[model samples]
Target: MTPEDLAPDVLTDAAAPIDPARVSDSLDHENTLKKDFVRRVRDCLEAGESDTVYDLVEPLHPADVADLFELLDADERPLLAKAISDLMGSEVFAELNDHVRELLVESLPAGTVADIAEQLDTDDAVAMLEDLDEHDQLAVLAEMEPEDRAAIETALSYPEESAGRLMSRDCVAVPEHMSVGDLIDFLREGHDLANEFWEVFIVDARHHPLGTCQLSWILRTPRHIALTDVMKRDQTLIPVLMDQEEVALRFQKYALISAAVIDEDGRLVGQITVDDVVHIIQEEAGEDVLLLSGAGEGDINEPIRESYLARVRWLIANLLTACLASFVIANFEGTIAKMVALATLMPIVAGIGGNAGTQTLAVTVRALATNQLTASNAWRAVRRELGIAVLNGATVAVVIGIAVSLIFGIPRLGAVIALAMLANIVIAGLAGVLVPLTLNRLKADPAISSSIFVTMTTDSMGFLVFLGLASISGLVG
Candidate 1:
C-alpha cells in the first residue's frame, strides 16, 4: 500500500479537531511537553484509561508525540503505543530515538511493523529495519507489499549509510526533449509522482541526468521554452556508493536542496533531499564525539550490555596505557628517594601536559572531520599546532617554575621542573597532532584511538622527563 493510503487514517477525529491553544498549553516555552501534562498522561495510563490517554495525546504534533514515548517508562511505552495506535504514524516513528523505536517496534506485530515501514520514505524505512535482527527483518519484509518490499530490499543491498541507501526512489525526472510547459502538464496529471520535490531532473534516454531546473524556473518560463534551455547544465551527482557524511558535505558546500544519486554507470537512480542530509549531519557529528571518548553512541537508551562492551574495551586499553606510565615511574624509585619533592612535583607536570594534549587533539579531530585538514595543508597544520604548543609550554613552565621556587626555596629544583614541563608539553603537542594525522593517513578513524595514544605519550614522557632531569641536574645527587 502507498503512504497516502495510511495518511487519511491518522488523527482524523474531526469531531474533536486539534485546537492550537490546547496544543500550546501542553508545551512550555521551550517546546517540551509540560511536566504536569506528562504526569496526567502517566496517571491515566496507570489507571488503565486508554481512551483518556489517547485524548491527551491526540492534539500533539507527531514530533511531540515521539518525545512523549521516549519520556515514558520502558514498559509504559508499549502501552502508550497501543493506546494511541492510530496516532503512531510514520512521522512519529521517524522522529523516535533509534533505541526507543527498536524496543517499541519489537513489541509490535510483523504486519504492523511492515505497514509503518511502508508509510515512511525509503531512507527512513531502511533506518527502521537496519537495526533489526535478520530473522525479524525478513518477517517484516514478508508482510509488506511487493513494490515497497522490492524498493526496501534494493536499498538494503547497498552498504549501510551509503548514498544508495539514503536516497529516496521517488523523484521527478523527465526526458531532455520535453518543453517546460509539457513537463508542467505532465506533473499536473501524474498520479504517482513524488510527494515533495524541489527540482526537476532533465535526463537523456538512458536516464543519465543532463541538468536540473527548479520548480520556480519552469513556472516562469514561456510554454515553448525547451527544458534543456532553462535547465542548468552543471549538477552535483552523488555516486551510489558514496558515504552519507560525504553526501552531506557536498550538499552543504553547494547549498543544495536536492541532488541526484547516480549508479555505477552514471544513470540517475534516486534523489537525496536536504532533510535527509540534515539528519545524517547530526548523527555523524554526535558519532564522532562519542567515538573520541570511546563511549559508543553515548545514548542513554542504548542496551546496557552493548554500552558495557563498548566502554569496557576502551577502559581496558586505558588501563594498559596507565601501566606503561607506571613502568616509567618505577624505573626512578631511587631518584624519588633522594629527593621526596620530586615525587610531589612529578604529577603536576604530567597533568598539565595531558590537558594541553587534549586541547590540540580536539582541534585536530574537528578539523579532520570537517575536511579542513588535508594532505595539501597537513604540514601547515602540524607547524601551526607545534607553534601553539611551544608558546603554551613556555607560559605554563614559567608560572609553575616560579610557584615551586617560592614555596620550596629550591631554585635548582624549580629549574629542573620548568625544563621538564616545557619538554613534556612540546612532546604532548607533537603526539596529539601527529597521532591523528598518522591514523587518518592509514585510513583509520582518527577519533577512535587517537586519545588513548596521545594520553600515553604525555603521561609516560612526562614522568620520564621530570625524574630523569631531576636525577642528572645535581639536585638529587
Candidate 2:
C-alpha cells in the first residue's frame, strides 16, 4: 500500500507513466547541465583556468560540442576551439553548419586544418577543405599525406556539390564470384573498409558494380552460397557527376540505405550513404526556401558583408518593381481626385490580389522543387488552379459586394467594386501559376523572380480594372 511497495508493481508494468513532476525535473537537470557546462568553460577561459575548461568539455558529445560552439559569441568561438583543439574531431566538424565551419576553418592555421582533415572520411575532409580560400586550401593540401591529398583532389575535380564530392571512398566491396563464406572471411580478415556500412557491393572484373548484398543477407544466408546468388541486382547506382540533389532524390525514390557511385567507365569509385543523403536533403530543402525569398543561404553565421550582398540585390529589384506599380497608380490620379473613395478602396483590391498571387506562387515553387510539377502535368496543374480561382472569385465577390453596399449605401458603387475584385482575384491566380511555370520553361530559377513578376501582374491588373471600371461606369465625376 505504501510508495515503496507500489514501485515493484510499477516496474513490472511496461506502460506505466512516470510522475510528471519527476519528468520535468529530469529535463530541467539536463538543461542545467548544458548551461553550467558552457558557463564553467567560459569562466575558466576568463580566469585563465585552462585545465578546468578542458575537463568540463571532455565528456560532451561532438554534436553537443558543436552546439556549445554555436552558443558562444563570435569572439568566444575561436577561444573555445583553441581550448578544445584535441576534442575538435571529424564528428564535430560534420555537425557544424557550413557558415560556421567555414569561419572556423578560416581562423585555424593551415597545418592545423590539414591535421583535422586527415582524421575525417574523404567526403567530410572534402567538405571542410572546399570552403577555404585557394591559398589556404593549397597550404592545407600540402600538409596532407600524399594518398589522402590525391583522393581529395580527385573528388574536388569532379565539380562542387556533385555525388563525387558527397560520396566516401571507404566502402566494403567484393568480387561477384566470392561465396558467402569467402565474403565473411574477407570481412573477418581485417580489411580496411568504411567504419559503418549497411550493404556490401559486388563488383565485376572491371570494378563495375553488378549488385549489392545487404548485411542481413550476409548474416543469415548459408556460407556456401555465392554472393551473386543472394545479391539484389536492381540496385541504384549513382553517377559520380550527378548533382547532390538528384542523388538525394534517387535515395528517396528507391528507399536505399546506400548506393554505389560509378565513374564514367562504370567503375565503382565510391559509395553514397544514407547519412550523406540526409544532409543533402536538409541542405537542398533549406536552399530552396531561401532561394524563394531571394535570400541566398541565409545562415545566421553568415558574415554581415556577405549577408548584405546577398539580400540587397533582391531589395533593389523589389524597389524597381514597386516603381512600376507606382507608375500605374499615377496614371489614375485624375480618377482618384474625382472620387476620394476610389483612392481608399483601390488598395484593398490590389493588396488582396497580391496576397492571393503570393499564395499560389509559393505552392507552384514547392511543386517544382519536389518534382511534382513536370511538363507532362503542367497543363493539368494550370487548369486546376484556374478552376480554383474562379470558385474563390465568386465566393469573395459575394461577401465583399454585400458588405460594400451596406457600408456606402450605394448599390452601384458596391457592384463596380465587387466585379473589380472578382476580376483581379481570377487574374491573380492565373498570373501566380503562369509566371513561375514560364520562368521554369526558360531555364530560370522559378523561385528567384516569380514573386516580383506575380506581384507586378496583380498590382497592375488590380489598378487598371478598378480605375477603368470606375471611369466607364460614370462613378468618377
Candidate 3:
C-alpha cells in the first residue's frame, strides 16, 4: 500500500477518535494492557472496523503494540497487523516475542520483511531473520540493500548466541590522530554514523581500537585536545566469538554502557550496548532456570510441538531415574510390608531431601553462570553448601523425629527416620554441588543435566537410607 493509503482519515461517526489523555484506560496500574482493551480490539477486528482498530492501537507505545499482538489469538494477530500496518514499524517488531514476530514476518511479503529488517539495528535484524528457513531467509536477504545484506550475512556467520550476532554494526570509531574539534565536526557531518552510541572509539590507522571516549568526556574536553588524551586507554574489548552470556557478565562486572567488539586480529568491528545486554541477561537467566526444570524455553508462545518435544525428553529421562528410585524401594518391600507406617513416612524423607538438593543446585548453577564458583573457589563453595545442608538437615530431622515419635508412639521408628533424613540430606547436598561442577568441567551446560542427576541421587539415596535404617534398627518388626 502507498503512503497515501495509510494517511489518517477524518474520524467517522461510526468510530470516534481516542483522546490521548484517555489512553491510560487501555492499561492497568501495572502497565499491562487491560483485558477490556484487548476485547475491544478483537471485537473491532471481527466486525471489520479496521479504522477503529488502528485508532485504538496507534496511541499505544511500540512495546504495548507488540504486547497486543501477543495477547490476540494467533489467527487474529495477522488481522491486527493488517489493520495497523503503518504502526507495525521496526520498534514494534523489535519488541515482539520471537514466536509472535516470526508468525507476522512469515505472513508478510519478502520485500516487506526486508523493509522492516533494514530499519532495525543489525543485531535485532539478525534475530528476526535467523530463525527463518534458509530459502525464506535468502529471499528476504535478496530484497535488502547490499551493505545491509553484507552486515547481516557476516553476523549470521558467527555461532548462535555469540557476540558477533549480538553486536550492532553501527558504531562511532575515529582515528586516534584526530583532535576533539575534528571529531565533533565529523560526528556532526556524518549522517551515516550510528544513531545512538554512548562512547566514541579511537582507532589507529588500521582500525585497531586504542581507547574509548565517553560522549560526556568529549563534550567537556577542550576541542584542541587529541582524542587519545581524552579517551580511556583501558577499556573492555569484547572478542567477536565470546558467548552473549559472557558479554552480559562483562557488562555487569565493569558497569559498561558500551563495549567495542573486536575481530581475531583485534580490529574494531561492532559495539554492544547496555540495552542489548539487558535482553541477553534476561534471556540467559530464564533459559537456565527452564533448562534445569526440563521445561524447554518456558515461553507460552512457543509452538505446542516444539514445547512437547523439549519437555518429553526430560520427562522420559526423569521416568528412567524414577525407576532407579523404585528399584531401591523394591528391595525394601518386605520391610515395608512388616511396618505399614513405613510406606506413609518414607515419602517425607525423600521429598524433603529432594527439596534440599534443588536449593543447592540452584545456588551452584547461578554461581557457575556468574563466574562466582570457579576452580579457584570450587571447593570452598562445596564446603559452604555442605555446611549449610548439615544445619538444615539437623533442624528438619529434629522436628520430623519429634512429630513422628509423638504421632505414632514409636521412639525407635522416629530415631531411625531422623538418622535417615540426616544422611539423605547430606547426600543430596553433595550430589547437588558436585554434579554441576563436574558437568561444567566437562564443558557441558551445568544447568541442563545437573538436576536430572541430582534428583536421581537424592531420590534413590533417600529411599535406600530410610528403608535400610528401618530394617536394621528393628523398627520394621
Candidate 4:
C-alpha cells in the first residue's frame, strides 16, 4: 500500500513511546541519534499509522528530522513522509542531505515538490530544482509562484556551485546616495526583508555595488552622514560566477561578515553571508578529503547505487595500478625464489614505504587545498619533504637493519636490506610529493589520481630496490 494509506493514530500507537528525557539525552550525548530511536520511528512508519508517527516525530527539531529521514531505509521514506506531511517544513528540507532530499522530491508529485520549493529561499530553491530531471524540473518550476520561479531560473542560469547559485536573493541593498538617516528610516519603514543581515550594500543607479556599510557603523554614525561617505569602498565583491570554494577563501581572507555578489556587468545581485560560507567551507573540505581517497562525496546518506558508482570506478583504477606493480614484482621473481627470506622481508620494505608515501601525500594534498602551497614556496615545500624523508629513512633503517641481521644471522644480507629500505623510503617521499605536484601542474584534480600513482610508485620501487639490491650483492644465491 502507498504511504498515504497509513492512518495517523496507528503510526503513533505502533511507535514505541520514547521518553522526553531519553530524546534529550540522545541529542545531548551524541551528535547522532541512537539506533533504538530510529527503529521506533521506522516501526511507526511500517505500521501505517500516520497520526502516531506524526506525534512521535513532531517533537524533533528540523535538523533532527532531516537526520531521521537520512537514517530511514529508502523504501520506508515515502511512508514516513506521508505519515508526517504537516511536519515536513522548509527547515526540514534545508537540513535534509542533498541525495536524500533529491530522492524525496523526485518521489513526490510535481505539484507537491513545487509547493515545497516555493517555501525555500532562492538559493535553496535553485538547489532543489537543479538536480531534478529536466521535465520534472520544468513541471515543478511551472507550479511555483511566478516571482520565485523567475528568481530560481535566473540563479540556475549561472554555473553550478557558483556564488550566483549559492547566494540568497533576499538581501538588503540601498542606494549609495541615501543618508544614514534615510537608511535607518528605510529599515524602520517595514519593507519586508531577510530575517538577518550583517551589512547593507550601497548600490549605484545602475545597481553596481559601490561599497558596504555595516549595521553597527550605520547605528553609530551621525544620521546626517551620507551612506557613500561612511561605507567602505574597498569591499570584496564576489563575481556571480566565482566558485563556492573561492567564495569561502574570500570571506576567510578578508574576515568579511557579508559580501556582495555581483553579476556580469558588476551589478549587485545578492549577498553571501558568513553562514553560507560556513557550509561551503565544510562541503569543500570534506569533498577534498574524499577526492584524495577517490571516494567521491562519501556521504552516508548517499544512495546505494550512486555510492557504488562513485567508488567502483576508483577501485577499478586501483586494480589496474596494482597489476602494474605486480608486473614489476614478477621481474624480480627469480631473486625472491633464490632467497625465500626476500619474500618475508620484501613486504615490510614495500609496506613501510607505502605508508610513508601516504603520509606525505595527505599533507601535500591538504596544503594544496588550503592554498598554503603555491608556486613561490612549492620548491621549498618539496625540499622540506625530502629532508623529512631522509630522517625517517635513517631512523627506520637502523631499527630494521639490526633486527634483520640478528634474525637471519647474516650481516651482509642485513646491510643490503637496510640500504634498500633507505633508498625505497627516500623514493617514497619524493614520489609522494612530486606525483601530486605534477598532477596539479597538469591541471588535474591532484587529489583524485595522486594516491593511486604514488602508491604504485612506492610499491614497485620498494620491491625493485630490495630485490635488485639482494641480487646484485649476491645475498641471494
The clash count of every prediction, one per candidate, is 0, 0, 0, 7
What is the Cα-based TM-score of model 2? Answer: 0.91
For residues 15-124, what per-residue lDDT tens digits would candidate 4 score against the true structure?
Answer: 34456764674464665777777887888777777677777776677788899889898888888887787667677788889999998888877767777777788887
Clashes by residue pair, model 4:
7-50, 8-50, 8-51, 8-52, 10-49, 11-49, 12-52
Write down the TM-score of every candidate. Answer: 0.96, 0.91, 0.96, 0.93
Question: What are the RMSDs of all candidates, in order?
Answer: 3.2, 9.2, 3.6, 3.7
Model 1 per-residue lDDT tens digits across residues 1-477 = 222322323432233468999899899999999999999999998998989998889899889999999898897887788778788878888999999999877777787888889888888898899889999999999999999999999999999889999999999999999998899999999998988999999999999999999999998999899998899999999999999989999998899999999999999999999999999999999998899899998998898999999999999999999999999999999989988998899899999999999999999998898888999999998999899999999999999999999999999888999999999999999998999999999999999999999999999999999999988888877
Clashing pairs in 3: none
For candidate 3, report its TM-score: 0.96
Please, what is the whole-model Cα lDDT of each candidate in the order they appear? Answer: 0.91, 0.83, 0.91, 0.84
Q: Write the per-residue lDDT of candidate 2 for residues 215-251, one digit (tens) a residue.
A: 9999999999999999999978899999898898888
Instruction: Estimate candidate 2's alpha-carbon lDDT, on a 0 to 1 scale.
Output: 0.83
Q: Report the C-alpha displacement of residue 84, candidate 1, in angstroms.
A: 0.5
Worst 10 residues of 4 by lDDT: 6-15
